[model samples]
Target: MTEIVFTPIGTVHSPFSDPRDMPIQPVGARGVRGTIELDPACAAGLQDLAGFSRIIVLYHFHRSNGYSLEVVPFLDKTPRGVFATRAPRRPNAIGISMLRLIAVDGATLTVEDVDILDGTPVLDIKPYVPAFDAYPDERAGWLTTTSGAARTMRSDDRFC
Candidate 1:
Protein backbone atom coordinates (compact mmCIF):
# COMPACT_ATOMS: atom_id res chain seq x y z
CA MET A 1 0.00 0.00 0.00
CA THR A 2 1.12 3.50 -0.68
CA GLU A 3 1.70 5.84 2.22
CA ILE A 4 -0.28 9.04 2.53
CA VAL A 5 -0.07 11.86 5.02
CA PHE A 6 -1.95 15.06 5.85
CA THR A 7 -1.31 18.16 7.90
CA PRO A 8 -4.33 19.75 9.53
CA ILE A 9 -5.09 23.27 8.43
CA GLY A 10 -6.78 24.07 11.74
CA THR A 11 -8.37 22.82 14.94
CA VAL A 12 -12.05 23.03 15.85
CA HIS A 13 -13.13 24.59 19.14
CA SER A 14 -16.59 23.51 20.20
CA PRO A 15 -18.70 23.15 23.33
CA PHE A 16 -18.37 19.39 23.13
CA SER A 17 -15.29 18.18 24.96
CA ASP A 18 -16.85 14.83 25.70
CA PRO A 19 -18.60 12.77 23.06
CA ARG A 20 -21.22 11.26 25.36
CA ASP A 21 -23.71 14.12 24.99
CA MET A 22 -22.76 15.50 21.61
CA PRO A 23 -25.05 15.58 18.60
CA ILE A 24 -24.77 12.64 16.25
CA GLN A 25 -25.12 14.78 13.17
CA PRO A 26 -25.16 18.35 12.00
CA VAL A 27 -28.97 18.57 11.93
CA GLY A 28 -29.01 17.73 15.62
CA ALA A 29 -26.39 20.39 16.28
CA ARG A 30 -28.46 23.22 14.89
CA GLY A 31 -27.60 26.61 16.39
CA VAL A 32 -24.57 25.21 18.22
CA ARG A 33 -21.60 27.51 17.67
CA GLY A 34 -17.90 26.74 17.24
CA THR A 35 -14.69 28.19 15.95
CA ILE A 36 -11.94 26.98 13.64
CA GLU A 37 -8.51 28.30 14.43
CA LEU A 38 -6.57 27.98 11.23
CA ASP A 39 -2.80 27.82 11.29
CA PRO A 40 -1.12 31.06 10.35
CA ALA A 41 0.42 29.37 7.33
CA CYS A 42 -3.06 28.55 5.99
CA ALA A 43 -4.51 32.00 6.63
CA ALA A 44 -4.43 33.00 2.96
CA GLY A 45 -6.73 30.12 2.02
CA LEU A 46 -9.61 31.84 3.76
CA GLN A 47 -9.67 34.67 1.25
CA ASP A 48 -12.80 33.66 -0.66
CA LEU A 49 -14.36 31.25 1.86
CA ALA A 50 -16.52 33.92 3.49
CA GLY A 51 -18.75 34.17 0.43
CA PHE A 52 -20.23 30.72 0.94
CA SER A 53 -23.10 30.24 3.37
CA ARG A 54 -22.12 26.66 4.09
CA ILE A 55 -18.80 24.80 4.07
CA ILE A 56 -17.89 21.16 4.09
CA VAL A 57 -15.35 20.27 6.74
CA LEU A 58 -13.19 17.19 6.42
CA TYR A 59 -11.48 16.35 9.68
CA HIS A 60 -9.66 13.69 11.62
CA PHE A 61 -11.59 11.78 14.29
CA HIS A 62 -8.69 12.36 16.67
CA ARG A 63 -10.06 10.57 19.71
CA SER A 64 -11.47 7.47 18.00
CA ASN A 65 -8.93 4.82 18.92
CA GLY A 66 -9.60 1.96 16.52
CA TYR A 67 -11.85 0.34 13.96
CA SER A 68 -14.72 -2.12 13.97
CA LEU A 69 -16.16 -3.70 10.85
CA GLU A 70 -19.58 -3.66 12.49
CA VAL A 71 -21.09 -1.22 14.96
CA VAL A 72 -24.41 -0.37 16.53
CA PRO A 73 -24.71 3.24 15.55
CA PHE A 74 -26.09 5.87 17.88
CA LEU A 75 -29.33 6.05 15.92
CA ASP A 76 -30.03 2.36 15.76
CA LYS A 77 -30.14 -0.67 18.02
CA THR A 78 -29.04 -3.28 15.52
CA PRO A 79 -25.42 -3.85 14.66
CA ARG A 80 -24.56 -2.95 11.07
CA GLY A 81 -21.52 -2.99 8.85
CA VAL A 82 -19.22 -0.09 9.72
CA PHE A 83 -19.38 1.32 6.19
CA ALA A 84 -23.17 1.48 6.45
CA THR A 85 -23.13 3.54 9.63
CA ARG A 86 -21.62 6.90 10.43
CA ALA A 87 -19.74 5.47 13.41
CA PRO A 88 -16.44 7.29 13.88
CA ARG A 89 -14.30 4.20 14.38
CA ARG A 90 -13.13 3.49 10.88
CA PRO A 91 -9.91 2.52 9.11
CA ASN A 92 -9.23 6.09 8.12
CA ALA A 93 -10.79 7.79 11.14
CA ILE A 94 -11.99 10.67 9.00
CA GLY A 95 -15.26 12.59 9.29
CA ILE A 96 -17.11 15.14 7.28
CA SER A 97 -19.85 17.65 8.13
CA MET A 98 -21.45 20.54 6.35
CA LEU A 99 -21.65 23.49 8.74
CA ARG A 100 -23.18 26.94 8.50
CA LEU A 101 -20.54 29.60 7.89
CA ILE A 102 -21.05 32.52 10.22
CA ALA A 103 -17.98 34.69 9.77
CA VAL A 104 -14.32 34.70 8.78
CA ASP A 105 -11.76 36.69 10.72
CA GLY A 106 -8.23 36.26 9.37
CA ALA A 107 -7.10 32.83 10.59
CA THR A 108 -10.24 32.11 12.59
CA LEU A 109 -13.70 31.09 11.44
CA THR A 110 -16.96 31.32 13.38
CA VAL A 111 -19.41 28.61 12.46
CA GLU A 112 -22.75 27.13 13.52
CA ASP A 113 -24.35 23.70 13.47
CA VAL A 114 -21.06 22.15 14.45
CA ASP A 115 -21.19 18.46 15.37
CA ILE A 116 -17.44 17.94 15.67
CA LEU A 117 -15.60 17.51 18.97
CA ASP A 118 -13.41 20.24 20.46
CA GLY A 119 -9.81 20.23 19.19
CA THR A 120 -10.65 17.98 16.22
CA PRO A 121 -8.10 18.51 13.51
CA VAL A 122 -9.56 19.97 10.33
CA LEU A 123 -8.07 18.34 7.22
CA ASP A 124 -9.74 20.53 4.66
CA ILE A 125 -12.61 22.94 4.02
CA LYS A 126 -14.56 23.41 0.84
CA PRO A 127 -17.43 25.64 -0.14
CA TYR A 128 -20.74 23.76 -0.05
CA VAL A 129 -22.55 24.45 -3.28
CA PRO A 130 -25.96 22.82 -3.18
CA ALA A 131 -25.83 22.17 -6.89
CA PHE A 132 -22.85 19.94 -6.41
CA ASP A 133 -23.45 18.45 -2.98
CA ALA A 134 -27.24 18.05 -2.78
CA TYR A 135 -29.22 15.13 -4.10
CA PRO A 136 -32.73 15.15 -2.72
CA ASP A 137 -33.67 11.96 -4.54
CA GLU A 138 -30.66 9.95 -3.53
CA ARG A 139 -31.29 6.71 -1.67
CA ALA A 140 -29.82 6.41 1.82
CA GLY A 141 -30.50 2.69 2.27
CA TRP A 142 -31.14 1.84 5.95
CA LEU A 143 -30.84 5.46 6.89
CA THR A 144 -34.11 6.12 5.12
CA THR A 145 -35.84 4.28 7.95
CA THR A 146 -33.81 5.39 10.98
CA SER A 147 -32.71 8.93 10.07
CA GLY A 148 -35.54 10.42 12.08
CA ALA A 149 -33.91 9.06 15.23
CA ALA A 150 -30.89 11.24 14.59
CA ARG A 151 -32.77 14.33 15.72
CA THR A 152 -32.95 13.09 19.31
CA MET A 153 -29.84 10.95 19.39
CA ARG A 154 -26.55 11.79 21.03
CA SER A 155 -23.15 10.15 20.90
CA ASP A 156 -22.39 7.51 23.50
CA ASP A 157 -19.40 5.48 24.73
CA ARG A 158 -20.23 2.54 22.47
CA PHE A 159 -17.98 3.77 19.69
CA CYS A 160 -15.45 5.33 22.01
Candidate 2:
Protein backbone atom coordinates (compact mmCIF):
# COMPACT_ATOMS: atom_id res chain seq x y z
CA MET A 1 0.00 0.00 0.00
CA THR A 2 1.01 3.58 -0.58
CA GLU A 3 0.31 6.78 1.34
CA ILE A 4 -0.80 10.11 -0.12
CA VAL A 5 -0.76 13.44 1.62
CA PHE A 6 -2.72 16.71 1.23
CA THR A 7 -2.42 20.05 2.91
CA PRO A 8 -5.58 21.88 3.90
CA ILE A 9 -5.87 24.98 1.75
CA GLY A 10 -8.31 26.70 4.12
CA THR A 11 -10.64 26.51 7.09
CA VAL A 12 -14.42 26.53 7.08
CA HIS A 13 -16.22 28.66 9.66
CA SER A 14 -19.86 27.79 10.22
CA PRO A 15 -22.55 28.16 12.88
CA PHE A 16 -22.34 24.63 14.20
CA SER A 17 -19.49 23.97 16.59
CA ASP A 18 -20.54 20.41 17.34
CA PRO A 19 -21.18 17.89 14.58
CA ARG A 20 -24.15 16.32 16.31
CA ASP A 21 -27.64 17.81 16.01
CA MET A 22 -26.67 19.79 12.93
CA PRO A 23 -28.03 19.35 9.41
CA ILE A 24 -27.08 15.97 7.98
CA GLN A 25 -27.05 17.25 4.43
CA PRO A 26 -26.89 20.56 2.54
CA VAL A 27 -30.61 20.42 1.75
CA GLY A 28 -31.32 20.26 5.47
CA ALA A 29 -28.95 23.18 5.92
CA ARG A 30 -30.57 25.38 3.29
CA GLY A 31 -29.77 29.06 3.93
CA VAL A 32 -27.16 28.23 6.57
CA ARG A 33 -24.25 30.55 5.76
CA GLY A 34 -20.50 30.16 6.29
CA THR A 35 -17.09 31.34 5.18
CA ILE A 36 -13.96 29.66 3.92
CA GLU A 37 -10.75 31.48 4.81
CA LEU A 38 -8.07 30.30 2.47
CA ASP A 39 -4.43 30.30 3.50
CA PRO A 40 -2.62 33.32 2.06
CA ALA A 41 -0.50 31.05 -0.12
CA CYS A 42 -3.62 29.50 -1.67
CA ALA A 43 -5.66 32.67 -2.09
CA ALA A 44 -4.75 33.08 -5.72
CA GLY A 45 -6.53 29.86 -6.59
CA LEU A 46 -9.85 31.53 -5.86
CA GLN A 47 -9.60 33.40 -9.15
CA ASP A 48 -12.58 32.90 -11.48
CA LEU A 49 -14.25 30.66 -8.84
CA ALA A 50 -16.92 33.24 -8.07
CA GLY A 51 -18.65 32.82 -11.43
CA PHE A 52 -20.26 29.52 -10.54
CA SER A 53 -23.69 29.65 -8.86
CA ARG A 54 -22.84 26.52 -6.88
CA ILE A 55 -19.58 24.83 -6.01
CA ILE A 56 -18.56 21.45 -4.68
CA VAL A 57 -16.61 21.50 -1.43
CA LEU A 58 -14.29 18.66 -0.45
CA TYR A 59 -13.18 18.68 3.16
CA HIS A 60 -11.76 16.31 5.74
CA PHE A 61 -14.18 14.83 8.25
CA HIS A 62 -12.04 15.87 11.17
CA ARG A 63 -14.57 14.82 13.76
CA SER A 64 -15.67 11.48 12.41
CA ASN A 65 -14.49 8.38 14.27
CA GLY A 66 -13.22 5.10 12.82
CA TYR A 67 -15.38 3.56 10.12
CA SER A 68 -16.95 0.17 9.55
CA LEU A 69 -17.51 -1.28 6.11
CA GLU A 70 -21.27 -1.37 6.76
CA VAL A 71 -23.32 0.79 9.08
CA VAL A 72 -26.74 2.33 9.47
CA PRO A 73 -26.99 5.68 7.73
CA PHE A 74 -28.87 8.64 9.15
CA LEU A 75 -31.72 8.37 6.67
CA ASP A 76 -32.47 4.70 7.03
CA LYS A 77 -32.48 1.71 9.39
CA THR A 78 -30.66 -0.76 7.15
CA PRO A 79 -26.94 -1.37 7.47
CA ARG A 80 -25.50 -0.53 4.09
CA GLY A 81 -21.97 -0.51 2.76
CA VAL A 82 -20.08 2.69 3.52
CA PHE A 83 -19.73 3.51 -0.18
CA ALA A 84 -23.48 3.49 -0.70
CA THR A 85 -24.38 6.26 1.73
CA ARG A 86 -23.12 9.78 2.43
CA ALA A 87 -22.34 8.89 6.05
CA PRO A 88 -19.31 10.72 7.46
CA ARG A 89 -17.40 7.71 8.77
CA ARG A 90 -15.25 6.39 5.94
CA PRO A 91 -11.76 5.12 5.17
CA ASN A 92 -10.75 8.51 3.80
CA ALA A 93 -12.81 10.65 6.20
CA ILE A 94 -13.45 13.08 3.36
CA GLY A 95 -16.78 14.87 3.00
CA ILE A 96 -18.31 16.77 0.12
CA SER A 97 -21.05 19.37 -0.10
CA MET A 98 -22.69 21.40 -2.87
CA LEU A 99 -22.99 24.95 -1.61
CA ARG A 100 -24.33 28.11 -3.20
CA LEU A 101 -21.61 30.64 -3.77
CA ILE A 102 -22.60 33.97 -2.30
CA ALA A 103 -19.42 35.98 -2.76
CA VAL A 104 -15.63 35.95 -2.79
CA ASP A 105 -13.16 38.52 -1.51
CA GLY A 106 -9.44 37.99 -1.47
CA ALA A 107 -8.84 34.83 0.58
CA THR A 108 -12.36 34.58 1.92
CA LEU A 109 -15.41 32.95 0.34
CA THR A 110 -19.03 33.38 1.42
CA VAL A 111 -21.26 30.39 0.84
CA GLU A 112 -24.72 29.27 1.83
CA ASP A 113 -26.25 25.88 2.67
CA VAL A 114 -23.11 24.77 4.44
CA ASP A 115 -23.51 21.46 6.23
CA ILE A 116 -19.87 21.19 7.22
CA LEU A 117 -18.64 21.86 10.74
CA ASP A 118 -16.65 24.98 11.65
CA GLY A 119 -12.86 24.79 11.39
CA THR A 120 -13.02 21.83 9.04
CA PRO A 121 -10.08 21.44 6.65
CA VAL A 122 -10.97 22.03 3.03
CA LEU A 123 -9.28 19.76 0.52
CA ASP A 124 -10.55 21.36 -2.67
CA ILE A 125 -13.29 23.30 -4.40
CA LYS A 126 -14.80 22.83 -7.84
CA PRO A 127 -17.44 24.59 -9.91
CA TYR A 128 -20.79 22.83 -9.87
CA VAL A 129 -21.63 22.38 -13.53
CA PRO A 130 -24.90 20.50 -13.89
CA ALA A 131 -23.74 18.92 -17.10
CA PHE A 132 -20.95 17.22 -15.23
CA ASP A 133 -22.34 16.73 -11.71
CA ALA A 134 -26.05 16.18 -12.02
CA TYR A 135 -27.72 12.93 -13.02
CA PRO A 136 -31.47 13.46 -12.88
CA ASP A 137 -32.44 10.29 -14.71
CA GLU A 138 -30.19 7.95 -12.74
CA ARG A 139 -31.29 5.91 -9.74
CA ALA A 140 -30.48 7.05 -6.21
CA GLY A 141 -30.48 3.51 -4.76
CA TRP A 142 -31.60 3.49 -1.09
CA LEU A 143 -32.14 7.22 -1.27
CA THR A 144 -35.27 6.72 -3.33
CA THR A 145 -36.87 4.73 -0.53
CA THR A 146 -35.97 7.46 1.97
CA SER A 147 -37.19 10.23 -0.34
CA GLY A 148 -36.91 13.77 1.02
CA ALA A 149 -35.24 12.55 4.25
CA ALA A 150 -32.05 14.46 3.56
CA ARG A 151 -33.97 17.71 3.57
CA THR A 152 -34.89 17.13 7.19
CA MET A 153 -32.43 14.69 8.69
CA ARG A 154 -30.16 16.03 11.41
CA SER A 155 -26.93 14.47 12.64
CA ASP A 156 -26.81 12.32 15.76
CA ASP A 157 -24.37 10.06 17.61
CA ARG A 158 -24.79 7.28 15.10
CA PHE A 159 -21.46 7.95 13.43
CA CYS A 160 -19.81 10.10 16.05
Model 2 error, position 120 (Å): 0.5
**TM-score of the candidate numbered 2?**
0.97
Lowest summed lDDT across 10 adjacent residues in model 1 is found at 150-159
Give the 10-residue window scoring lowest on summed lDDT in candidate 2. 144-153
Clashing pairs in model 1, backbone N/Cα/C closer than 3 A: none
Question: In candidate 1, what are the lDDT values of residues 99-157, reduced to their tens digit?
Answer: 99999999999999999999999999999999999998999988998898777788888
**lDDT tens readout by residue for model 2, 26-143:** 9999999999999989888989998899999999999888999998999989999999988899999999999999999999999999999999999999999999999989998988
CA deviation > 4 Å runs, candidate 2: none
Could you estimate the TM-score for every candidate? 0.98, 0.97
